[model samples]
Target chain A: EAGVVQSPRYKIIEKKQPVAFWCNPISGHNTLYWYRQNLGQGPELLIRYENEEAVDDSQLPKDRFSAERLKGVDSTLKIQPAELGDSAVYLCASSQETGWGRGELFFGEGSRLTVL
Target chain B: GESVGLHLPTLSVQEGDNSIINCAYSNSASDYFIWYKQESGKGPQFIIDIRSNMDKRQGQRVTVLLNKTVKHLSLQIAATQPGDSAVYFCAETKSSNTGKLIFGQGTTLQVKP
Candidate 1:
């Protein structure tokens, strides 16, 4: 039983460049989440997907940030024309639909984005 | 969402001693609470959880205390070790299936050997 996998572990780009992250959830998990953790701060939810349907994305910056879970097992988060403020760790997590939003989550190491 | 600063409150304790990390949440409607441990260069991992109906829940060597009246939460680590050094976060969510969690400013736990 492998845990959630994300790549690449790190990325460095200049401001206004485009960046993308990929995530693979654990087997049989029906819910996936993307969270952003700024320096020294707790993670904040960016979007949540339930079997390919995005149930919550109010916190995502629609203008520059977009996400998709096409097949329901893997997910991608994209930032177009990224800003300096976008530098942070992009974390992907997954849980059981049975727990819905109330269960334990397994997380990946996360993709660290550094925008200069 | 709660405002977070770059500097987090830190708790230091000696190894083999008890450790208590406290968090104050603002949402009274939040019924589900969770504690997460995050090490450097890693995402958060769940430690323990408590619902509004319950006040205490214990795990292998950890305990979570929920005070619904004041919207407060605490995680207690018994016989702390150096491996327990990490940033601890407390998250709350309103009752639903969205899994939208509001996280507080994390507390850094430094266990001294």
Candidate 2:
């Protein structure tokens, strides 16, 4: 089966500009996640979706970041007025909803963003 | 804020040697842990996983040991190969359902061939 797929494997933007990333989860997967990995840091959770409803987005920078998972099959993450510090690799992952504890998570080749 | 971090930033090992990677987590509520391997420009790929209920789980040439008491986790790779070179990360989930994982800082493994 095809793994999770993401668009624009890389992106470059000036500080204060806006950018968006897209993700398509594996077929039949019910859970989707968005994570940001800064240089030398772990991937931090930005949001999570179970179907079309966002179950966890507290970590997302609401002031400038927003996400959507319409139809529960795909997701999009956006950042406006991007900061230099915001430059990082954004990863999209998916898993079957049977429960993350049992099944493994699959990730896409992340979208690397560079802010100039 | 809870976090997961690796003890080493990098690990160098001989091609035939075993490699062990360690991680420390702060969330006591976390009940599941996973180890992932990521090549440069690629995303993290699952290597192995263990639940809080079990202390050790083994998979194809890899083993994951979880210590809920100390909030420590370890991944051991047997007979490491050059292809094993990558950044390794340990991730934890507080619950079994959300599937939202909190990843570690990651350890770069360099297999000396």
Off by over 4 Å in 2: A98-103, B1-6
lDDT of 2 by residue, B1-113 (tens): 01125487889999989988889987898888889899988888888878788999999989888888889998889999999999999988855553767788888899998
Docking class of 1: medium
Q: Global lDDT for candidate 1? A: 0.87
lDDT (10s digit) by residue, model 2, range A53-115:
998898999999999999999999999989998999999999886364464778899999999
Off by over 4 Å in 1: A98-101, B1-8
| Model 2 steric clash pairs | none
Q: Against the unseen true structure, what C-alpha lDDT does each candidate score? A: 0.87, 0.87
- Interface CA RMSD, all predictions: 2.3, 2.2
TM per prediction: 0.93, 0.93
* Global fold similarity of model 1 (TM-score): 0.93
Question: How many clashes show up in model 1?
Answer: 0
lDDT of 1 at B18: 90
| Top model number, DockQ | 2
